[model samples]
Target: MICLNSLGKRIAYLRKRSNLTQRQLMNILDFENLSRYENDERKPNIDIIVKLSKHFKISTDWILTGQEHKSYRNFQHKIELDDNEKNFIKLFDQLTEFEKGQIIGRMEQLIEMH
Candidate 1:
């Protein structure tokens, strides 16, 4: 039987790789007070699992049952997001609100120019 504790660990691991904090991930999953689940203090049910899988864009089966050959859950194969593709996320995190708006305006102008 797959342990709920282990499942929580996998969830936390993938969430971190996605560059999301527990609070941020919980917001997307619409689960309040989700820290306990990530910390393995509480178990998440099937409904939560479904939401989590969808939010992370991964297979529920893959998340629950890790690959037989690997020690980790290998979500990279399940969800591919290259650095170049998600660079805007890094910039958005680093930039201030005003700076973000300026960058958006610049991008819009560049797009219009093309």
Candidate 2:
């Protein structure tokens, strides 16, 4: 079984190493309940585990096991992801289809502006 308390520590460590605060992590994690996860009062489910895994570009097993690994590079192809861009991708993937459309529409508007 994964030690959730230790997992919380790893999460804290990675978040800090990435130079983000708990509130900032909440922006990516997007859960009002995330305080409990950071504090080790509650463990996240596998769904959340996979979400965080992809968000950070780490494996779920590594995250649960608290193993050290390379930090995720915020790029794909020629596009480098700023912190806010990364946060958006992480959160956007979790949204409902309607929410996704709204985001896409906003992105289209942003593209049209430039």
Candidate 3:
């Protein structure tokens, strides 16, 4: 069963694991909403849950129920990045925030053009 209190704890755990303050996570959700969520004052809707899942690179099922869906668990073992992709991630990690944002913006624009 999905428990809102447990869900809040999971969200808080993900945020702390990423070393992000509630304010920093504001890019995905407002501080006030995040604070309330973390305090178990309210539950997030499906859209917010999906956003959190993407932001944390985690399964929404894990966030909601602390269990990995069987299909998602199986999919996790199939991830295999090539050398170029691995190098790109390493290089991207070394970039400044502004540079990373610029790169992401350009990538978005390129995707839109396709």
**Every candidate's lDDT:** 0.74, 0.73, 0.83
Tens digits of lDDT, candidate 1, 1-114? 534347667888788889998888888878865778777788788778777776777767766764343433565557677898689677675775578779899999999999
lDDT assessment of candidate 3:
0.83
| TM-score per candidate | 0.51, 0.51, 0.57
lDDT of 2: 0.73
TM-score quality measure for candidate 3: 0.57
Those runs of model 1 whose alpha carbons end farther than 4 Å from true positions after fitting are 1-5, 68-114
Residues 2-60 of candidate 2: C-alpha lDDT, one tens digit per residue: 34347777666666768887778778877556668777889988767776777687777
Give the least accurate 10-residue stretch of model 3, judged by summed lDDT: 26-35
Off by over 4 Å in 3: 1-5, 28-32, 75-114
- Report how far off residue 94 is in candidate 1 (Å): 33
For model 1, state the Cα shift of residue 25 in Å: 0.9
The per-residue C-alpha lDDT of model 3 at residue 109 equals 100
lDDT of 3 at 71: 86
Best by lDDT: 3
Q: Rate residue 26 of model 3 by lDDT.
A: 72
How do the candidates rank by lDDT, highest first?
Answer: 3, 1, 2
The TM-score, computed over Cα atoms with residue i paired to residue i, of candidate 2 is 0.51
